[model samples]
Target: MKVVIVGNGPAAVSAIKAFRKVDKDSDIVVLSAEEYPAYAPNCMENVIRGDIGDDALFYAGGFSFYEKYKVDLRLGKEVVSIDNKKKIIYVKGGEEVSYDKCLLAAGASAFIPPIPGVELGGVTTAKSLDDAKRIRKWILEGRVRRVVIVGAGPIGIEDAETLRYMGLEVSVVEVFDRVLPRMLDKHMADLYMKPLEEEGIRFYLNSQVVAFHGEDGWVEAVEIKKLGSDRSIYLPADMVILSTGVRPRTYLVEGTDIRLHVDEIKGRVVGGVLVDEYQRTSDPDVYAAGDICSGIDVFGRHRWIALFPTAQQAGAIAGYNMAGLKVKNPGLVDYNAVKTRMVTAGSGGLFEEADESHTFELDNQIIKIFLRDGVLIGYQFVGLPKVLSVNKNNPFLKDSITFKFTGQGLEASGVLMHHFMRYRDRKVTQKVLSVIKNGALRSLANPSHDIPLFSL
Candidate 1:
């Protein structure tokens, strides 16, 4: 068998290894548009700030790992189109690669909203290593003084922190009422915002960028309108970074037999490849993973969530199934942990995503666990226990006084909650809380288990 993978990120890398594990003799080829080898895009911040060098950005030894795995890795090559019927992939240089199985882990591109003057020279997106390199160069040369970020999501907040660390005046504008609206609840988001404000990073909530003002083809100021009012304001900026999330690179499927999933409630076609539990798309010979594919949301509906770990797991499953292992993806769980201004905040599963919920707050720490019929479904946390003062009346505070959950806390919560979903017992919430209090949360580090958290 010959396998052609359309990306070289974590997904493609894992897929290659998985395929080799099941079918060692099969030929594997990876096509990457990027000149550099696979590196964690999430770690690009440290790379930009010089905390870590470019060499440290790679994972599992980068491209050399693929070479050692006996996979043909093609760098700086773009897969333009796929002829499913012909079982061939066309590359940028008019080269065609024949494959028995194709994996479209093409990933996503930074979404640049159609705001006016957005094409100006001073604007850029933080989607790749090359982008980080360019931004770092622009900063080290003292070309940027005042920076404006157009979104308040994780990427936007990260960029704000990094630029501020570089001594640039940073401000973030978000159309939502609060920052991290998708990740944290309003109250939790406000808790996370306090420290960011203290760090001198300005946030303009409920604001939408209408246009970018440019001087000599370079962005000079951003024109934004308050969501509910006719009032407009211009923020003078020497550089503009668009951290406005991303959409899957679905354009690669254009004219292929691939089918994009449609959002049932929104009545719009989802922006990713639709695949079954086995990660097989409409074309039997083609599979998709990573940001390019849609997976089960916390609500049990297909949703496009582009997170790194999910992409890796999905790719592994896709590769396994492609190798005829018949493994099934357990679906995706929403989880994210972001550190801004040296403070960490995390969320897992649902937040205001369900009907019933409970909230507990103490000092800088806040925990809001979502539940359905007495079973825990999700939770969110803002600070560490050492930073949080114990509240005597709060039952959840007893064991949490010195509790130190690892970074895996957020991702583990989804697993525990989902497992509890099977039992209809009323003690579901109490059982999960006990598990956390007994320090069993640490056991979630085991690779096999799905992993939760608080006092009842």
Candidate 2:
């Protein structure tokens, strides 16, 4: 029994571990296009600002973990295509690998739009560990001072926060009217983004980058135009990061018998290869996970939630199904938490579809709870960093007051919402509101007490 996994990410690592748990004797081979050990994608932000090497972020405890599991880990081997009919994978360099079963966890890559001047030397995207290292190298070499981030997504904002912390002039340009359009609505985005603006991270909303102006084939400035107006601005830049978004590496199955699902959400295409509850695709011998595959959400909506936890669970499930454990994925909850020095924010589930919603505006915190017929359907919690407040000695304020204590609230909400989805009509929303209410009251009474506030 020989198994081949297509990536070296969270999904692939979990799949390998889970599969080994059931069938240790099965020969496992991992084919990763990256030339390094499996690394945690979430740590890229911190790693960028620090002087640590890539080895510090290995997902499966370095190569020793693969060795302990008796797995064959092939580096820099990009699977160009997989012939499902023949149960064979074709590598980019004409290498053919045969397997009894395969897990398509090839993950995703940063989507750099076909905008002019994008090929300039100083332009990069925050998708892989190397991307972070490159940016860090430029900063360390004094090559970066004015950083122009081309998108206002999580990657861009986080990068802005880090750069701003390092005393660099950071600015974000978003075609959308607000920041974090996918995770937050306009109003919520305003609340969370306001403090960051105060922190000196400029945001250009309702604008599009027309071109990247550069000299000597290296980026020098960005040319942007305000939509619906004859307004243009040229912002000087030492570096440009395309934080637009990501796309799954789907070329491997493009001409194969394997199926794919593509759909548009909020004007952006967000779909991948479809997978069942067991992580099985159309082909029985082939399974897919991670950002490469879309799974069912808690609302029974078949959508792709490109979050690390979701990928990890999907990989574990795919591994189980491959090991003959007949398990079904419990479905995903659309949840995410973004933490910065200026603020912390988290949102999840159904926001607009939820029938009734309530909001509590407390000191330096904003919490919104949405319910669909009394079920925990949606929520948005944000909290500003205490440093941002003018009243440094406010008697009712604690040290952090989250937006963890902000992003951690989302993790807490995710757990509670999962219970609601599992039990169905469990009346969990009321209990959730109670917890939220208690935090609000605690903030009003004594701000010094550490309460999460379901904060930003």
lDDT per residue (tens digit) for residues 400-429 in model 1: 232222243344444444443443234445
- Report the error of model 1 at residue 67, Å: 1.4
Candidate 1 lDDT score relative to the true structure:
0.77
Q: Give TM-scores for every candidate, taking all chains together and pairing residue i with residue i.
A: 0.87, 0.88
Which stretches in model 1 have alpha-carbon errors above 4 Å?
Answer: 264-267, 297-300, 362-364, 384-427, 434-456
The CA lDDT at 121 in model 1 is: 87
As a TM-score, model 2 comes out at 0.88
lDDT of each model, Cα atoms only? 0.77, 0.80
